[model samples]
Target: MSPQPVLLPRRHWLAGSGAALAAAALARTGPAAAAGETPAPGAAGATKPLPAYAAWKDPSSLIVHSSNTIETRRSAFGTGVITPFGQLYVRNNLPAPDASILAERDAWQISIEGVKNPRQLTLGELKRMGIETTAMVLQCSGNGRSYFPDKPGGTPWQVGAAGCVLWSGVPVRWVVDALGGVDPGMAYLTGTGGEKLPDGIDPKSVIVERSVPASAMADAMLAWEMNGVPIPLAHGGPLRLVVPGYTGVNSVKYVKRLAFTARESDARIMTHGYRLSPPGGKGDPSQPSVQEMSVKSWINGPGTDGTRLKAADVQIHGVAFGGMHAVAKVEVSLDAGKTWQLARLAGPDLGRFAWRQFVFAARLPAGQFTLASRATDAVGNVQPEQRMENAGGYNNTSWADHAVKVSVA
Candidate 1:
């Protein structure tokens, strides 16, 4: 079942040598692993597969943590997580190659040089050169990182790292207008991932490389399906690089080369990890981090540990997003964060960049309780309980504050 790729609208070519000093020599060599060592065969180790749910809860007792439960429901705007499918959240940076040698290797190319005819193409020539889908929403520039207050260097991720899927691929401005447009002094576009820098880490580390610009690579994209299947190898199978609104570490995974520069590409995961710092301001380890993704929201399940209302009128779903916009509203606070109300949004099936599920209803006020939620987008923004300091903890977004503890006689 391998043969899909046909979508056009190309233009791209930018040549090299700018490298920004090899992106500071790959961020002073830093991703070779070895501190506790274990990630190698398809990496992201520690034991890998998770999300069965039976135990492991704590992240303020599930306001949303325990690695962000995959799915759950309670209603009246009170218990939600619902990510579903394989439980989402994979977030790899590197470590997912060898998918049966990429489905029996049809030679698997995809070269595309600066463009105008650099060519390499394969995966059935990008599915006869005409595939496109795009739903967007990747997240994970560290997702939440244990809520990072001070303990943040890399991947402590909590809000289940993030996900939205849909992808499909080929756009990226039709491979930069078929390789012949983006040159106007092009300013960065790098991207490489086929998995290789493991062994004790630091093959000149630098997160293994990923750069942006070229107007964010003409809105970037190369994905090869996901949610519509074909994108599994730990979540980067065959190809990946969706950058829409950024984050997810510049949306790169097993991508294996993209080039087109004028500067920025020495990789160390693109000049040292998913950066951010503007809104409330604070991050600037010498600038260069704002990779996108900000407005966020959460409220996974019967959290604050206090569920018992077998019935009596309850409904409080949750899930709001804002990496690319279009959430617009979703408030619900029971008290903990001090007054808020307005839930019920849910209508926009996957495009405003995905993620928008809200509900609200209450009629129990009998025993114990604690509930919360907050989200606001459509440009209004909102959603920020903390995050804004940045140095390493990368983009966060903040606004967590979820809580559950219900009991209503």
Candidate 2:
């Protein structure tokens, strides 16, 4: 069948104003000492306080992982924008205060409200709460934002706007139950982080407060461990919120408080930002933007050096993901953008929220070439080349197929 034809208006805001508020909050909480900086270390050049939506602007901080042994043209994927030694994505909630300011052990506390007997728990108390582990892919809603056809109003994001890691922590329901179960009429559960925003930015803007229905709280988790250890301070140490299948914006980081209420929260951070135009333009003004991740795939191997391969057998590999559903198919193309074929898939075991690995092996002919891949879900949702326009920076549904230059020896 021919490629699906969809018209995505050109004017959409990829990042939400709430994201800016979160960034501004981090800047005001005081500079996170340079020690925890991940990717680039101490090489400070263009390191400026990021706007709420500009989380992935720092290039040096991106985490790079490649399976191919090629060293000349390195292939890797990052969680977000590259910062000093790690990648940055504008998180909807504020970051935790630096260890230097709060001291890892004594700096944070978790408060549970709206229960019959609310209580405050420290990180140590939380550790004893029977922690469960899950491997999840934490991605910004605007991960491949730059790919969006140039438009006004959106956060600037490159390909490295997402990351996958094993997360470990206490389930949100566990904490709520420990506080003597929730009361009736509770429809929203709000989470608060410990970080503060900069001087000029509005505190109302920086403090991220979002609420989910009590029914959804059963699945919400408070993660403290990542990839087998306590989550790094830079990555929301002590505690963070993990709401699987929802856009990263709803997964608040640096979690400090949880409140159950009968009414939906009026936090501007949750209501006004990260929202997409509802299907058929009938938007739900009351519902928050907590939809499943859209299907997406990326080409990450055989960079500049692939150009030297002779017209022989070649291995093309990349990654694919569909928020909560199984990736039913992944198609690849080699002739610029003409014909297409299926690629081998691996890794549905990583859970519904993780990215799957895929590969296509074919005999390439001696000539210049272009390559691309598109992923489809079991729900019949094929990845789109673009998305419908909106004001916030929410570009989750756009296709990320890439064209790389290669030559045969």
Candidate 3:
């Protein structure tokens, strides 16, 4: 069993102070810090203030990593399927465009290329083309970085940097069909963000452009609204690309360019970043790009604040999700995986990409116990016992690393 963490008052954890303390501890022990690797210039730390657009988030429900980076607290997820806007995490690759841009939201234009008749489409014009909505899990590429033993160079996120959300937009397929279809040789779909570029730097070096498999366009969309409202600027307003079953970065925020390419984008972000590298290795074009997420699940209720529970009936509940498939079932292990019991899957099945809530009830006597959850997807892919080691600590779906340790009195 994993060693117990130091216990703290519930109030501290709930107020977000203890969450900061936990993040600081993880940062100090990361492999980069241990090997004396210097932090990149201007790299944000755990103490930066939240950005103006994120001021509405509940401080008690998030761990602020930087002005543009914040994560939801696992406990704050509660039992809801649709994460409340105030509790959803915020992650921005570049500073969001000024809120003043919302003044002419309908007039925002997106250039479409690689089609028989390439043209620009205004947000208002696209809205008149077709409308569709989908619910999917929007997760960061390094969501489980803290669980990596080698420790990566990004935010030490755990299970909170992800959430299921509803996006409404014009389907990419419909747009392409109306525009006379994509070029015959196109093999990739690329989206470019609209954030203003910093001066004196090669725009390609820092632009947010990602090229995904052309097949993704089947479920891809140019989303103008999130959770039923005009997409908030903080989360990418005016327009954003929504790719279901893929990592959040692929859903370009403030998207301004949509194109079908014969090859992937040449942007540095596409050619050099978000790649899966060997342990202690540097990312490069040879490495695989972060795309679709994998099957994962973890306990959320009975928070891991080291609190003691009563020696009676206890209800254990959490969430499970399949990256591209539906979760078949969730199993609960109260004795650190020694014995398992099938848990009741609660709530409505939102779809294959949406998470399913799982609940289990158990009676216990005074003792120390560890709780864990295992999930299997429709294709027979089971959540693993351990995570694969990698330079960026990207995909982590291990049951052991995410298990909750608690005491029953």
Candidate 4:
């Protein structure tokens, strides 16, 4: 666990303030913000403006469930090539980072340890080593927990806790490689977000630290920039780990440490949480850990379940992704799963980890209808009709398995 002292870079840390925000706000005072408008670009660091979702090309009408737990409704899933940064789902386990901290991105530091020669590096230094960008989906392990058959007692997320983001940062392996290469014997490469918990919570129980398999280091990045901007503090700013194809928790926002070790952190998150327990059972360590997501798809538009509309040629569109590969094909079903129609894939293939957007259209007479979709990945993985039940609701991709009914007047 020996880590060298942090070597701060030449960049000066910026300070944020309210007056600066007010000045910036005045310029963008459109009809939208009646007064005291949210700050636009060039606002001081202190101005933590709410991101523009409904305000900027927002279609799904995303919901805010606390600053940290917002949900992206099903209609928004296929709205665009990239989920708007402001409208992206939020699932912060801890309090969201404040503006001051995010403004200090230049000073962000991560301590690397446990290897033969450990060292500490600032965000500036990490960028010098190597910078790569990959667009991928960051999904909460329990995104659809609310629909679990057994019923879990945690956040009732309904497939809204996931989004595709373009993340850019130094390869995590660069850190491991810098630390004199990894020792093969080590099983897990542990890391942690630097956020502190409240006084009453037991420090040991807090999952400030969690980990990914060492093999995953090859695809992981210690990202400081997301979606072409400095990573917002709300997401995981200053720095965060972006492990493509893994659950969002594995991304570990506000990251500050990296340790390659044989033992998993005793933190509740690593052991008790994120487990795939048996149906109706509490988390069981013996069961497999929640890692890659399963094949899944969601019909995003033409309104949500039970949506009523006049008879017309309704366009049905959605998004789908594979656990470990690009989505090869996506199919939609109107009369439940009795018949399926291949939907057209659209836009660019950001990467295997990024979901593929699909669209289908049909002219409907006045009547009641149901819609459903299934996806097949490049690796031959097919979306299942029924989700595998687990008490924790870790990977509820099966939420898309059922038919959603809509009314056509």
The candidate scoring highest on TM-score is 3
lDDT of 2 by residue, 192-223 (tens): 66776678866656577766666767557888
How many pairs of residues in model 4 come into backbone collision? 2
Each candidate's number of clashing pairs is 51, 34, 0, 2
Model 4 misplacement above 4 A? 1-60, 399-402
Could you give candidate 1's per-residue lDDT for residues 1-409 as a string of tens digits? 2111212222110122212222232223112122322211122333433433322311111122223222111221222222323335555555445557566433556566665556677666666556666555676776555556565555555554565555666766776675666555667777777676667856647355666776765557787756455666666666777777677767777676777777776555555445454333444335676577767777644322233555467766667777766677888887656788898876334446666777788765666666767788776879887776665666666664334455666
Off by over 4 Å in 1: 1-113, 116-135, 138-150, 153-170, 180-264, 268-297, 300-317, 320-345, 351-353, 366-409
**147 Cα displacement, candidate 3 (Å):** 1.0
Q: Write the candidate numbers in order of decreasing TM-score.
A: 3, 4, 2, 1
lDDT for 332 (candidate 3): 95
Per-residue lDDT of 321-393 in model 4, one digit per residue for the tens?
Answer: 8756778899998888889999999866666777788888888778877789999888788888777787776
Of the two candidates 1 and 4, the one with more favorable TM-score, higher being better, is 4
Candidate achieving higher lDDT, 1 or 2:
2
Better of 1 and 2 by TM-score: 2
Query: Which ranges in model 3 have alpha carbons more than 4 Å from their true place?
Result: 1-48
Which scores better on lDDT, 1 or 3? 3
RMSD of 2: 11.9
lDDT for each candidate structure: 0.56, 0.57, 0.80, 0.69
Which candidate comes out best when scored by lDDT?
Answer: 3
